[model samples]
Every structure is written in C-alpha cells, then in structure tokens.
Target: MNDAAMPKGPATALEHFDVLIVGAGISGIGGAYHLKQQCPGKSFVVLETLESFGGTWLTHTYPGIRSDSDLYTFGYRFKPWVGPPIATADEILKYMGEVIEENDLSPHIRYRHRITNATWSSRDNLWTVEAERLDTGQAVAFTCNFLWMCQGYYRHSEGYTPEWPGMADFKGRIVHPQTWPDDLDLKDKKVVVIGSGATAATLVPAIADDCGHVTLLQRSPTYFIPGRNANELADILRELKIDEAWIHEIVRRKILHDQDLFTRRSFEEPEAVKQELLAGVSAFVGPEITEKHFTPSYRPWRQRIAFVPDGDIFQCVNRGKASVVTDEIERFTEQGILLKSGQELEADIVITATGFNLNVLGDISFAVDGKPLNFADTVTYRGMMFTGVPNLVWVFGYFRASWTLRADLVADFVCRLLTHMDEKGARKVTVELRPEDKDMPLSAWIDPENFNPGYLMRGMHLLPKRGDKPEWQHSQDYWREKEELPLIDLDDSAFVYAGTKARTPEPVG
Candidate 1:
C-alpha cells in the first residue's frame, strides 16, 4: 500500500508480515531478494530511513569516496559488476539502483520510513516495530514475525565531531567528510585535514591538486597498503572469452585467498615483517615524512589501513602537494590550528576526516516484553543473530574481506531457513551458537578497543568459536561459506522452529 492509504499513528494490534527488514542497504536488499525468491507469496517490506535507496552509497557523498574492496569480490555474485574493479560511489549507487529495478523490488520498499524502536512479544510471537517518516515526521507501526536488521555500523546521516577546544572559534570554515558542503570553494586555499584513517588518506591527495597546501594531521599511525583500482585479472578473463560467471568466481576466489594469506602472514610472522611493511610505507613517503609521522606503535592490521592505487597518497606527499603533522591538537585558533608542541599551522579550510560514528544495529532500540536490550549483555550467535532474540536474524559481514561476499552467504542462509520453515510448517526459528563455542580467538583484524559510537563489537562470549576446518570456521573465505552455509542442510537441532499455523497475513488492504 502507498503511504497515503496506510494507517497513521500508533498501531495497537499486530499488522502481520512474513518479514520486516530495516535499512535498504546492501544487506537488507540482499535479504529481501532472497526472501522473495524463496517464498514468493510471503508478505514482506523493507523500511528505509532515507528518501532514496542505496543506504551508505546514497548517504556518503564525500569527495573521492569509493569502495576500498575490489568489485569482483565486492559485487553480488548473482549480478556481475560490469564496471571497473574499485567502483566509485556514483557507480555503486547506480548498480544498486539497477538491482532494485531489475528485481522489481520497488513495490516492496517503504522509503523515508525510519524505524525508531522494536519490541518482541513472546505471547503473540511478534515484533512491534515503531517508525517515523523523515519527511512527514509522522509515526507509524508494523508488526512482523521476523525482523531482519541490516542497518550498517556507520551513521550515514551524521558526522562524528570531537570536542576540540575553540573549534567553533576557528575563523576558517570547518567541514566533515560526511557533511561536505557543496558551495565551499577550497581552490588555492590552504587546507588542514585531521585524522589518519581511510577518509583522510583518500581526501588529502584527492583535493591537494586544487588547494594551495594540504596538511594531514594525525595522532596515531595506521597501516597504508596499495592495490590497483582496475582489476587486471578480470580484464584478462574477459579478453580470453571466459564465461562471465566463471570469470567472476575465479577472480573472487583469487582475491579472497590472497587477502586471507596476507592477513595470516602478518600475524604469524615475526615482528620484523610488520616493521618491514611499516618501513615500506615510510620509504614511499620519504624519511622526512616518516620521521615526522609515519611510525605507529601498533602492529599492522590492528586497524584497517587506507589503501590507494600505486602509492597515490605518498606520491602527493613526495611532490610537496601535501604535508603531514603528527602533533596532537591543542586547540583551534581564529587564524589557525595550535599544536601541543606550541606550534601553529594556518589554513583556509579545516577538514575533520577524524573518524566515523559507529551506530551498531542502526541505533534502533530493542526490547523483549518491555525489558530493553543491552547489546553488550547479550551474546552474538554466529556473529549475526543474538541469543535470546527470537525469530530474528542479522547480517554482519567481514571486516577483512569484501562485505558482500559474506552478505551473499547470509542471504542464501536466510533463504534456506525460510524454505525449511515453510516445508516443516514452522512459525518461528531462532539460531544461537553453543555457549562453550565462544572461547576461540577471533581474527586479529577486528579492533577490540576502538569503541566509537558507530562501531559494532561482537562480545567474546556471544560469538561462535572458530571451527577446526575453514568450512565450519568464521573465516571470510568465499569457498568456505559456499560449503558451510549453502551446501549444508538447515536440519540442525540448535535452530528451533515453532510449528504453528499462524502464518503472516497478506499486506493490508
């Protein structure tokens, strides 16, 4: 039903649905597509906060923004990426649009509807979802049997701004990458970029050519690796007249395996290897820049590094188009930024590429019978679903591998679960890992201490232990996921389903 015809205000009774998906991002879309394919007649709807779709791809409009992962692995397996390796934001957005249209998914989406809270009712076995429309500010509610949360970690609509003293007093215009102003002209103007994460590294070199001088300010160091933006392997496969599906599979496997190997070696080898990697970054930036800032005490991959093609960031620094400052920010002055070492640097514009605000589970509060959920208190089961939350599933992909790879697996798993439920006459199903299964050490790639508001941390006790073999393990290996999630049957005793006749009603008239 269209927004005008739908009921307004609080919905007291359960408005039945087979599935209710929050956030229309990659994960949500994947889930919806799989659900529709598996259960054609099932009633489902996707509630998106933004007026437009594409989730992060639509919200993040920062300059030079692009996917860090290669498209061969990053893009959906069902839909081949008919573009360059590392896709730009606009290209990715267009691809998402195409996916929605090609699948005829527009009718299933409720745009501008932001879910505010969801509470599960044990007696009725339903979740009451409360939401508000961004454009109209009118509240609405929906009740569904299954609630799938695909809201990503980053708060796409908001930017993270640290409380730097006298920040407001700075005479120059300050901007954050999340909310970059369109009218602000930085041409021939001195620019100071704060933070050393992916955003800063990418932005520094990108805007340097137009600006007079660009200074990258950082408090700590991050690993800087480089990769080609265009996939040579994909091009070669295409030239060889290989099948499109075969080419995608081959390239995806190769890249995923190579990344896994590199990550393993970084941790398994001696400290010298980590040092050597850091030294390589230092060498690329030159000793003068290295001595001033390139050295970070943490090991490689403690946090993800900012990547570029052919050492672009270093090249910009070497050409004197940009500079680095390792000093801590003391305060912002009317004319410039004052450093802790009693030094100051003047700038016409200040870009706080500091970091993202991680809003885990899309900042939507959840409760079971009015008892609010403390996410930290509950354990994460399979790094996706939580223990104790019934008839719910979540999509959480790799921090190391391409997100879509695992997302595709999770989508397939959901479809399998739905099919099983239908065949067995089950009303609800909830999957949780065994308690003893949480002791295994997780991949070192995930940051344990970094507790930004936007970040999502799976507690040690909540996550499943790594399996002995790669197939059963929580590895980001695509072949492993294909074997474990897809090929495996959904008859495991751990996933209990209530066999009842209370199927979700059709969409409201």
Candidate 2:
C-alpha cells in the first residue's frame, strides 16, 4: 500500500478533481454553486469549449437576441434577476460574468477545452477524460470521480441548416444565425428570414426598421403568444420601497404559477387555450392575416410556442416594414428564392433562422471498461442520470418552464447524492436497471413520432431511451418533478452503492 507503488499511466499524468463539470453555462454555473454550498470539500473544474463562460448567450449574437423565458425563473435560484423580465443576450452574459467573478469561478474555468472523449473505470472509480484545445488542437486530459454534463442539448459547432434545391445558385449573401459574422453589414437591404421559429420571430422585428424590407418566410405556421416586455409589478413595488429579495421571490412564484396553469390548460383543455392565443394575435393584425400566418396546424404545447414581446412581430407586419409568407421554397435563383407557388422573393441577404440540432452531451464519445457506451442501449433515470452509467449526470432543462428551474433542482439533487456518497464512504455509485424491471416497456425518449419539434426529431435516435417505470421515467412536467426529485427515497435497489472499485483506471488512445 505504498504511495509510490501505484501504476503511472495516462490517468496518472493528467490533472484530477473530485467533480468535473462539462460546461460553464447556466446549469454548469449553478452546479458549481451547489457543489460549493453543499459539499465544500469537493474540488471541481468547469471545462468550457468556447472562449467565454456564457454558453448560448455568448455564442448567439443575432440582433434582438433575448430570453424566451422570463429572467425571474431563468436566473439562478440563489441569485435575483432585478433587471427586465426578458433580458438581452449582452445583459445575460454580463450577469454570468458577475457570477463568475463574485463566486470566484474564474480560475476554475478552462476555456477552449473541448472534451472529446470520456472513459470510466470500475476499479479506480474515476473517469479519464480527453479533450482538445479548439485553437491549437493540443490534446488535454483530466480525471474526476464524477462527471457532470450541463452543455445544453445542442451542437455548438454548427446549427442545423437543411440543404434546399439549387441553394448554390443563390447570388445573395446567405447567413445562418448560429454562425453569424461580426463585420457583415445589412443596412437598408431587402432581407428575408426563412423560418417561423423563435429565432426568426426575434430577428424579423429587430431588423424591420433597419432593413429596407424584411419578410418571415415559413413553410408552416408556428404558435405566437404576445407577452409583456416589462415587469409592471416590480416597478410598482419599487415605488412602495419593497426589498429586491422579496420582489424577486414574489415575482418568481407568480411566474411559476402562471406557467404551470398555462401548461395544464394546454394539455387538459387545448382548444380553449388555442382560441385565446389566436384571438390575441387577431387583435393585433386582423383575422385574415392571423388565419394566413399566425394560426398553427398543431395544438399548443405540442410544439414550442414562441412569445413575441408586445406583439413586435405583428406590429412590424402591420406597419408594412415586415411581411409574412406562408410558403415552401421551390429553388434558389440568382436574384432570390423562388417559391413553390410561382412567387419570387428578391433578397439582398437571406438569413436562415432555423433552429439547432439536439446534441446530447455535446456529442462526446463515452466508454466504460473499454467497451463503447451507446446511449440508445441505455435508459434514463429520473431525467438526469442514465442507467448503467456510473457517476454521470446529464443536465437537460425544462420544455414548458424556465430552463433554470429544472437545472437548480438537478444541481441540488446531485449535491445531495455526492454528500451521501461521501458520508457513506462509498467509492463507486452506479445506476442500473433492476432485473425485475427488465420487461418494462422501454420506448424512445419522448417517442420520436410524438415529438413534433424538428431539433429533437433530427437527433432522436441518438438520445437515451426511457421506460414507463418510475425510476426509468423522464418527466417533462416541472411541478411534478419539483415535488418528486428532492424527496425521492434514495434507498432503491436499482442504484448500486459499493465501497470497492472493480479495476484500476486507464486511458484510451
């Protein structure tokens, strides 16, 4: 048992930590906070692939880029978002930097460190991870007892850009919002935004006045709900001189309650809610235009419903600054795009505001005991951890509510689990499906057929499966999970707690 007798291998040559978080975004930053507050003894590092800390906020710089969800719940549970309910990307990035500086997380972040592979060892109870510096292509390695994934469920390298017929023939400047250029000029140009998603909605109103003409070209309609841009309650409360902490708590709770009610109505009584939403749109731009462009084919909550602050998109359309075209692209001509209906759209700049591709764990390869880890073969546990995956947590946020709500809860659960392991002196903790539940009906995560969103549909086969069993289920309902996860009994036999490692750690080439 001499300290010098241990084998010197790839793991031995690499840096080690108690916990290795794979992102430095909203979820990852919150994870760091929980780790510090609950388990102060654990040493951790946040490895970010980008040059900056904010993941989405820093990566996306399109004009009018702002939060889809209100900042009250989108913000960290420990901190208060005192600014506008909907914050701009710049403000959000600044907030993230403040959190890093105030909490002293700057030194722990290794920017441009893209984790490419992760291998787990049963004997050593550690993960030997390999990453590469994006700028220099230099290899880097790190070892950690637990690995946390908070990189969001999308590809950072590129957005999903579907190839259209004759796209190469387009003479105009084509731009994808994900990889927007910095110096590109678009002053007083006839710009066409192709898509009906949130990104397209955001861009149209933003560039309406600046550009000579802007058009939102969509193959199909998307649900649009008009929301208030500013928080009136916070303004009124400040007049009465209420403290910010109280204002934040009261506003957060009120927003959560409203979100829960809206989600429930979408499921329980969709028709009524659908009419209410469409009526709001009709009030802005008559029923004729609403029928042509605003009404969606599918029901609400089946797909993402984009929130347009103060009917900005509708206002732009009514003023003749922007217009909506519900049609499909026939082909890209030299001057512009040709529609299937024989309509031609002359554009100086064509911006593809299409969404991203859902990339689980940032497309990082995983292995255990030298065997490749296939996510399709594994099942999810409590929407965060995967079956047979030891000491790894995947941070996926909520669909109906603010992303940070689920993130905060997941972080808390992880902290609690780590504290328990430390208290029990357990060397390895693994989640595996019990034999009694082998016959349980396992299905695709959210059933690709049922999942209507294009981003998730494109990468459905790559995601982990979920079963009907309670332990194997991944609930999207925030209110239900809020009540279940924190108080869930951890004494289940499915999760194995062991004090001995099966083998020593080694790295793969």
Task: Say which candidate scores most in TM-score.
Answer: 2
In model 2, what is the error at residue 85, expressed in angstroms?
Answer: 0.8
Q: How many residue pairs collide in each prediction?
A: 6, 1
Mind giving the per-residue lDDT tens digits that candidate 1 earns over 283-333? 687666675677777666656655566677888988999988888999999
Worst 10 residues of 1 by lDDT: 450-459
lDDT of 2: 0.85
| Per-residue lDDT over 49-99 for candidate 2, one digit per residue giving the tens place of the 0 to 100 score | 988888999889899998887898999877878898878999998888888
Segments in model 2 whose C-alpha atoms lie over 4 Å from true places: 1-12, 448-451, 501-509
Best model per lDDT: 2
Evaluate model 1: give its lDDT.
0.75
How high is the CA lDDT of each candidate model? 0.75, 0.85
